[model samples]
Target: MLVGNRVILVTGAARGIGQATAVFLAASGAQVIIHGRSEESMDETVRLIQSAEGLEPLRVAYDVRDEAGMKLAFKQIKKIFGRLDGLVNNAGIMTEGLMGMVKTTHIQEMLDVNVTSVILHMQLSSRLMLKNKQGSIVNVSSIIGTRGSEGSAAYAASKAAVIGATLSASKEWAGKGVRVNAVAPGFIETDLTAHYMENKKEKLLETIKMNRFGHVEEVASVISFLLSDMSSYITGQVIGVDGGMVI
Candidate 1:
């Protein structure tokens, strides 16, 4: 419910679910650290948060795939905020391709950005959280990771890896007061998913029990809940934000 005064970091906060989550968390009173590939990309997100009269957010720009950049970003957070209370691993890339036809470059990029970076960030963030003996982390996954889709084999593999990491990390740090969980969204209407919405809207709708694609705010709300005390007892679980698509 409330994350007031908590210091949180949201990666890929320039757009889509990441942007929405950063805005929502800022509005809810968290001191949000907005991260993007470049400071210019975060302008709109920063503007929206400021317009809401939320706390002034800290801005960090770095490629999630770059280890040195990520380390520097964390160091900046530590120097500025003194402690990290929450982390949302919302930065990821999804490149769709069928198994045999998928480009090797696409697969590697997905693994590096979606899976590798997530684990590294988790590692860095958990250390900061452990010092405080309490913290929360939320990773953005997708339904495709759980139930494979036709043209997303490699993408699915990357997200599936996230789910696995969340489970393992939760167990590793739960006793030390760090909680890790993931949100597996279905058909969310974000820029990343615009292609599917444009090409297969009706067909995708038929599969979801709710008969609708989700909105960015819908997923953001769940991420906020996971970061707050409302989900204090929840960890190591992959909460589906899908419209009953998997069922």
Candidate 2:
């Protein structure tokens, strides 16, 4: 119940960590907004939140890469909720292509979704948050952002850019009652990472000191902390929930 009466918006809420965070926040008493590119999936997430006795989250289906869509979505949010207390930039993708096979389009898409969307979301959200003189933003980064991963150069680069932006924005809004931070999750058991686990489950576990993949709930709790008053004194930092993998 860390976010009682708060308003939260999460990207990529159709499934995986985004869905988990949205549900968790709603259960904590926040009026959550579930956003994704798929209307059906967003609806499913809404159902789950309702099933858990959590508040029914508003579902918004829009591509994060669409600039106009982004503006309209945020504007619509303002029309509905009037103010946003927390924002989680969690929409992202990973393409598996070797360096030689990677194309320019793949790189651009990653940059657009992972890096550019985050920058613009923060820019607009900050303006609204600044008016209320209180807000929290959490960017969902990855361990690859810290340690470059093979076959994921573009993804790693985009996430690294997220970490950089989180640090910079945190500093910029320090005294404005806004806190910007990032959570770098490693080897999470989610739909996005299912393929890798299917093939290299044992190998991956060996790399993690905890000998297991991180859970979506674990990452969601960290998000809740950052969004709650518990983390009021913390900002501009990237917390790793990697099970000692990145250490």
Candidate 3:
């Protein structure tokens, strides 16, 4: 395994892509720390990873936007793992609204969770990674961010900011051994998107080249690669895991 013995922390891992990434990384032999807002939800993620890989992930519960709590998380991570090797900034929220009708608070909420939190997580995690001189950060963006969606202005803007942050962060750490990248996933089948997918099935399928909602594991595969040595020379890249949805 390319990441054996490495310590990787994945935020927003209670379910969906975050959960899948945590499980996949554990299966790939990396020691994973699952972060989310609830201990119960994180426990379920740990249980799933244990069932699939026979290895349980360490759990860290905190709102990614909570700076003080996150500082404590990093301390705890260092206390337990000694070093941070990888960080997956997968925590975000999706809000839907026409740009003209979107409420101010709704847009702010989207930006806070999807963009601000990612920057804070990357900043704090990279500080720890700098000591080790090598690390990788993978942010989760969306196809809407790249192609613009009609009723998803806030969500698109937030995700677009993720791409911007990823680019600047990569340049900041370019020759310092810390790599930053992002995965812009298309319509993925998960509890959070299940309702929307079901409601817009016919319309959604028409836009996807693959004609199917992506599985969490499929997106997880790309995230796992970015966090591993297999992508050693890759940085400042946004790999779309949307089955060519944007194409």
Q: TM-score of each candidate?
A: 0.98, 0.97, 0.96
Question: Among these predicted structures, which one has the highest lDDT?
Answer: 1
RMSD of 2: 1.2
Among residues 3 or more apart in sequence or in different chains, the pairs in candidate 3 whose N, CA or C atoms overlap within 3 Å are none
**Candidate 1: residue pairs that collide:** none
Evaluate all candidate structures by whole-model CA lDDT and list the values in order: 0.94, 0.91, 0.88
Cα distance off (Å), candidate 3, residue 112: 0.9
Residue-level lDDT of model 1, residues 43-133, one tens digit each, is: 9999999987889999999999999999999999999988999999999998887788999999999999999999999999988999999
Pairs that collide, model 2: none
**What 10-residue stretch in candidate 1 is worst by lDDT?**
193-202
Better of 1 and 2 by TM-score: 1
Give the clash count for model 2: 0
* lDDT by residue (tens digit), candidate 2, 168-210: 9999999999999999999999988888745577877878998
Q: Which stretches of candidate 1 lie over 4 Å from their true place?
A: 197-199
Over 4 Å off in model 2, which ranges? 197-199
Candidate 1 vs candidate 3, lDDT winner: 1
Scanning candidate 2 in windows of ten residues, the lowest lDDT window is: 195-204
**By TM-score: ranked, best first:** 1, 2, 3
